[model samples]
Each structure stands twice: as structure tokens, then as C-alpha cells.
Target: MSFEWPWQYNFPPFFTLQPNVDTRQKQLAAWCSLALSYCRHHKLYTLDIMEAQESPVFNHKNIDRKLSMEAILIVFEELRKKGNLEWLDKNKTRCLVMWRRPEEWGKLIYQWVSKNGMVNTVFTLYELANGDDTESEEFHGLEDWMLIRSLQALQMDGKAEVISMDDGKGVKFF
Candidate 1:
């Protein structure tokens, strides 16, 4: 007797979690690629596990499979191991999707400062965050911590200096 297999039939076992490491690695890579693409396209800078609706990894409807927080953490941990993701907060709830690193951010800031003649100029942190002087396609609406860390990194390298003013609102960068 000969048996015929349906070429287009959906197999429930295909969705079942595989135990093999190689298969799991491939699955993770695909998922990460999709997640990263979605995040980048949406300009998403942070992901919150507690608030899962915004995350693409958890909002998929095709398979009726929702990723648990633990699963999401494991995948994020793997991405971190591969240097593709970074945790921005102490609780590990908010992550910085580091397609570019802090060093790169520092370099971009330095270039912008040089290009726009912002060096030797006195500006406040609030100004930097929402200033007309630094208004441009880049560095606009940049996060405070990321900007400070990038500036500090530049300062450590002797490329720039940060000066504090008496008003408690001004931080000059030169």
C-alpha cells in the first residue's frame, strides 16, 4: 500500500516547541530579526515586558501563541549576549535597541557639535533636550540619560567638557 501526503496541510506539530538546540537557535534568529525590524520601523527605543501590547513579539495573531515574559527575557538575553540589545534601566524592564552603541552616539554628537559650531557654547540640559540651537534631524528629542552618558563618554576621551552653571538648570558643553 502507498500513502500520499498533503503538501499544503497545516501541521500542528510545526508550532510545538522544538527541543533541538540548532532548531531553537534558528527560530530565535528569525524571531529576533522580525522583532528588530518591527522596532526599527516604528522608531521604538524601549520595550516594556509589563506593558506587552506594544511589543510586536507579543502581539502576533496568526498562531494564537503569545510569548511569556520569561520567554521574552530569554530571547532578549540572547540578543544581549550577541550585542544586539541593551537594558537601559536597573530593573531590566526597559531596553535600548542598540543597532548603534553609545560610542557611536558619542561620535555623532561630536560631529554635530563640530559641524554646527556648537562647541564652546553654553547651553542647559533642558536646552539640549529642547533647544533651538541643537534643533536638527538628529539629537532632537534625544533622551536625557543617553545624551548625558554620550557626553560623559566624550569627556572621558578629552573630546569635550561639561560645565555646570549656578542656576541648576544650565550645563555647558565645550
Candidate 2:
């Protein structure tokens, strides 16, 4: 037996907000999951609302189905409040999504260093980012600010020390 569509109707202008809390919660959860996964996969540390590409809101193809900037901001703000994201600047134009927080990055760096027998070896931050000796799969092309922040966190834990190079163009980690 084959099933056939019994009802063929187009409902236009159904301006009704969902009143069920459970349904709304489920919807919100789904949206959040998509947003976070997108951010993580793209390594989008920062998101700018004015910049349409950075924001998940705004759809160029479907103008009628676009999400308002205010709505997008609300979702980002909620994420920030929950400690999942942070504003990089005062204007709130850019946001840093904490898929993996600084503390976790610090631990990972420490583990990598210990595992690779680089605990006491002195190396520049740039070297860590693009070094042939280091794990190219992990730290290559990583954001400098993120790497520095992670190193600083490790420093606080006495896991590593950051020193300024003589040239002032780079930093050495020991």
C-alpha cells in the first residue's frame, strides 16, 4: 500500500507564537546546537552582527524569512551570559565563542609539551604556531591571541613561562 497526501493547503499569514513551553524549549535547543556546531567547525572565534556572514541570522536568498539583528543579538547574549561566548571589544561587534575555553587549551598545551619532550626547551610563540618540531596538526595557524592567552593561563599554574624575545617581535615559552 502507498500513502497519499490527504490535505493540500497553503496556510499564509499564520501569525501565531508557539505557546507550548516544551516545544519552545526543544526548538531553542535545536537552534543552539546548530549555532554552536557551526561556530566550532568554522573556528569562528569572533562573530560580528553587522557582518551578515558572521551572524547566523539574515538570509540573502529568502528575504521574507530573515531573522532580525535584535533576535540574533539576543541568542549571542544568552550564550555570553552562560559563559559560552564573550565580546572581544566594547562595541560588541566581535564575539569570541568558547568552544574550548582558555583553561582547557592551557591543559592541552602542557600535555603536548610534556609528551613531546619540550618541557624545558625554549621556543618562540611563532615557532609553536608554525614549527616543524611541534604538532603541526594541533597548533599550526592557530590564533596568536588565543595561544598567548592559553600560555598565560598555563603560566599561572606554573606549567610554563612566557618571556619576551630580545627582538620584541616574538615571545619565548619555557
Candidate 3:
């Protein structure tokens, strides 16, 4: 799906950083919303800020706008502060975005598994994510890292167990 930026996004001045604190705050908030929406729309759970500097998100084709690294970092920093994203590396290079937190995702997973009588059944990570049995589920095609996080949330409640394997991974719901 394609995303259409709001009017402010097309405004030439919107590409430039505002000098005033109040204006900059508003711009930052707008940018945060845009980034969150884009990630959610694309099911994108991770973002590399440095990589984004050269991507279409930063480079607006029609307006010929691009964000400087300083601006990118500022926006990303704000996002981190708000808990919408968290740095994955010490250098703050990449982030795990939370359009939907692991806790919420865990609840969805539990519901899906219960509906399918998967509770107390052993399932390889591959089966849960890519098996034909799960193709119609919402959590199908979930990234392993994200799935592990979500299951970890469930694990806190004693609702799931994750077992490591030489080949892949396995999960048993309880």
C-alpha cells in the first residue's frame, strides 16, 4: 500500500528544521506520527536510522527534499524518548519499533493459539509462522525476533514455553 503524506509534509519549509523551540516540538511530533504510521502500514518492526538517510522516506521525489543526519537523529531520538522505538545497538544505529507492543502481540498470539486448540501442543517456530495451518492467522509470517519477544511476554504469564533447537526453535503453549 502507498502512503500519502499530509499537507505539512509537502510544504517546503517542513523539510527544514525550525529554529523556534515550540515549532520544532510540533514538527517533531508530526514526524513521529508519520514514521509510526508508515511502519505500521508496512508491518516494519525495525528501522536503521542511518539506512533511512538514503531511502525514499527521507528523499521525497516530487519535492526533492532530504533530511540531514542531524534532523534524522533528532527525530529518532524523540521517538526513543517516547518509547515508540528502542535502540537495539549501543551506537543507536538500529531500533525496534513498537507500533504494537510485545504484550499486546502476545495476547493476540494466545487468542489465536487457543482458537486453534494449539494450547499445550508443540509447535516449531516455522510451523507457527509459515506452516499451512497458520497461513490464515494474523501472526503468520511474523519475524522470529519479534515472535520471540511476543512469546517472552507470554512466558511471563506462564502461557508459553520456547525451546531452542539446532535447526530452528520450538514453542509450546500452555
Candidate 4:
């Protein structure tokens, strides 16, 4: 699937940080939206600052414009404040991006289980993510860390329980 770039992406001025506070705020907002949409379309759960700077989303080769590293940091910082990103290191080079919150993912999983009448059934993490039954599901191909977080969200709501077994971890939906 191809990601559609926002209109701002092609605007050369959008690549630079604006001197005006209000303009900068609007610019940052646009950047945050673009970044989240791009990551979601690519199914990217993690991001590296250097890698992102080179990615098409931030680098508009057609326009010969690229967002400055400092601007990217500001955009990411905004995302973090909005609860959509989490830094993974002190250097802030790597981060986890949550386009959809764990609670939202948990709700989707729970709804699927209920709709399929699979409630009360134990399912291995792999099965939920990569099993044939879930191949056509949105959560299919979900990374284990994100999967665990989604299950944990469900557990907090008393809709699911994560079990650690000898073979691996599993989950039981209530």
C-alpha cells in the first residue's frame, strides 16, 4: 500500500521550522499528523531518528526539501506529549510509535474474540498474531511487544489474562 503524503509534504517551506510561534505550531501539528499516518500505513511500530529523516515522509526528494533534524525532534516531542510516542533511549534516537493506543488494540481483539465466540479460549501469542485464523484480521502480523501491550490493556479491564507457560506466553480472553 502506498502512503499518501500530506499537502505540506511538497511545500518547501514546510521542511524548515517557522520563526513565527503560531506558524510553527501549525507546522508541527501537520508534521505530527503526517508522521503518524505514514507510520500507520507502513505498519511501523518503531522509529529511529536517523532512519526517519531519510524516509520519504520527512525527505521530499521531488521538492529537494528535507525536514531538519531539529524540526523532526520537535515534531516527535509533540507526539510524545500527546501520548502517541515513547522514547526508547536516553539519546532519543529510537522510539515506539503508537498510532493506535493499546486500549484501542485491546478492544479490537476482544471484539473479534467475542464475535467469533472464542471467549474463554486460551490462545498462544503467536496464534493470535500469525495463526491462520487471524491472517485476515487487522492484528495479524502484530509484533510481540505490541501484542503483549494490547493484551495487558485487556487484562487491566478484566477482559483478558496473559499466561506465561513453558513453551511461551499465551492469553485467555474472558
Candidate 5:
């Protein structure tokens, strides 16, 4: 979806803890939907839970209101349980917001490899992410950690294998 804000976007109660159980549930749902849309629109793949209050959508400049860290943590926990975000650290402070899940990304890469006759080819992680040939790819310039996660997903399906080189890791699509 586009970046259209919901009618409840700027509603003051949207930022705080709700007393009623039903209201709180609805509020959490709204928060998650809003966050998903906003992050997708911005092509943001991660959400720093601790810094959310200072980030867009969470920080409301016009109303001078921001979600407290506690509120952010609560909503983030709900989002995590829904499989829309993954905790990056054991502390539950940083999250890898899965606007597009890593498994899907791995499939996309596999398709690209097949279409381009890259299967059975050994390519460094660097090449798959930043080579001139992949400049136009959707996952071009992807961060190394995220790229590895995607590759690991492929490995689970017997689609790829990783080779440790002196410089870095390489992937053999099969």
C-alpha cells in the first residue's frame, strides 16, 4: 500500500496506554498496521525499538506527543509474535522489520539465479549484493547480514551452499 495515513493517525489516544482491554487490542492493531505501512513505504528493513520514539510515525511533531519506550516495546512485542518482525538481539532492543520476509527474498534470489544461468556458479557474497550485474536487482547492495540470512534460508531448501573464502563468503546456487 501507499503512504496514506489512517483516520486514527493523529488521534491522541493512539500514542498512550488504553485502559479498556478491547480498546488496547484495537490500539495495538492500529499501531502495527501503521508501522508496517510506514516502514514499507520508506524501504526500511529494521526498527530500533528503543529509538522508535524519536523515529517517524512514532514521534508526532504537530501534537508534541511521542510514544514512551514502554509503549514502543509493547507494540514491538506484539508485532514480533505476529511474525512481521524478528528480534535481532537477545535484549529485544533491535528488530529486523520484515517488510519482506527473508524466505521470500531467498526465493527471489533463486529465481534470478535460474533465469540468469547463475545456478552451479560460485559467487562471492560481495558479487551477489553489489556487483555491476546485480545493480538493478531488487536486493542489490543488501547488507551482508541480511544477505546471509536469505542465503541461509535457501540452504534449508537445498537451493544454495556457502563457501568460506579467504576474503569473505561465497554462495553456490544449485
Candidate 6:
């Protein structure tokens, strides 16, 4: 499915950083929503600023408009502040985007496990993400880091426990 761009994405002025405080704040909010939804739809867990600039979400080819580097940085910063993004480096070149928080992912996983009567079962991280049984699940193909985080969230809730083994990491649901 094609990603749906926000109304502001097609507006020329939206590409430029607004000088007015209120307008800029609203602009950043729109940008943050767009970025998160775009990443979620594409299953993009990480973003590099350089790569993102060329992406359709940040570059509106139809309108011949693109968000400037400064504006992109500002938007990313806003996302970070909202707890939906985490910078991966001090230079702020790369970041992890979380449209669905770990806790939310954890809840989905637990629900699936409960539905399948898989409680008290031990599953390798790979099995949970790439196993045939999970192929039809929303969490299928999830990145390793994100998967681990989701399990950790479950662990916090006492619904799951993460186990480390020689081969790799595993999880046991309660």
C-alpha cells in the first residue's frame, strides 16, 4: 500500500522552517506524525539522516519540495522529545523510530502466545520473529533489537522472561 502523505506535505511552505513559534511548533507536530506513520508502514526501525533526505516522505518529488536538513533535524528532535525516537549516535545521524512502543509490541506478542496456548514455552528470538507460526503475525520479521525490547517490556510486566543461551536469546511466556 502506498503511504498517505499529510496535507502539509504537499504545501510548499511546509517544506520550509516556519519563523513563527506557533507555526513552527505545529509544523513539527505534523512532521513527527508523518515520520512515525511512514516508518511504521514501511517497517523501518532505523533511519539515517542522509538516507532519509532522499526518501519520498521527506522529499516530495511531486511538489519538487524537500524538507531542509535543519528542518529534518528539528523534526527528529521533536520526535525524540516525544519518546518515539532515540538517537543512535552523538552526531544524530542515525536514530531508532518506534511508532509502536515496546510495551505495545509486548502486549501483542503476549496476546498471540496466549491465544496459541504457548504459555510456559521457550522460544528462540529467531523463532518468535521468523518462525512459520509467526509468519502471519504482525510482529513477524521484526528486527532483533526491537524484538528484544518488546520481550523486555513483557518481562517488566511479569508475563515473560528473557533467557540468554549459548546460541542466542530466548523467551519464556507465562
What Cα-based lDDT does every candidate model obtain?
A: 0.64, 0.62, 0.84, 0.93, 0.86, 0.93
Question: What residue pairs clash in candidate 6, if any at all?
Answer: none
Top candidate on TM-score is 6
* Clashing residue pairs, backbone N/CA/C < 3 A, model 4: none
Superposed Cα deviation of residue 63, candidate 1 (Å): 4.9
lDDT per residue as tens, model 4, 1-174: 577888888789999999999998999899999999998898999999999999998898999999889889999999999999999999999999999999999999999999999999999999999999998888888888889999999999999999999888999999
Model 4: lDDT of residue 89: 98
Ranking by TM-score: 6, 4, 3, 5, 2, 1
- Comparison by lDDT, 2 against 3, better one: 3
Q: Can you give the TM-score per candidate against the true fold? A: 0.70, 0.71, 0.88, 0.96, 0.86, 0.97
Q: Is 1 or 3 the stronger prediction by lDDT?
A: 3
| Count of clashing pairs, candidate 6 | 0
Q: What are the per-residue Cα lDDT tens digits for candidate 1 across 1-88?
A: 2322222113333334457988877756655665666665554656776675444345445555456666677778877887878887
Q: Residue 38 CA error for candidate 5 (Å)?
A: 2.3
Q: Judge candidate 4 at residue 110 and give its lDDT.
A: 94
RMSD to truth, every model: 8.7, 7.7, 1.9, 1.0, 2.3, 0.8
Model 3 whole-model lDDT (C-alpha atoms): 0.84
The whole-model C-alpha lDDT of candidate 4 against the native structure comes to 0.93
Candidates 3 and 4 compared: the better one by lDDT is 4
- Over 42-159, each residue of candidate 3 has an lDDT whose tens digit, in order, gives 7788888877787666667689888788898888889888888888899888888887778888999899899878799988878877889878777787778888889889999999
Compared with the true structure, what per-residue lDDT tens digits does model 5 show for residues 1-174?
Answer: 557888777788788879899999999999998998888777778777757778868888888778888888888889888988889899987888876778988998899999999899999898999999888988886778778989999999999998887889999999
Candidate 1: Cα lDDT at 128: 73
- Give the TM-score comparing model 5 with the true structure, all chains together: 0.86
- Two-way TM-score contest, 1 vs 2, winner: 2
User: Candidate 4 deviates by what RMSD?
Assistant: 1.0
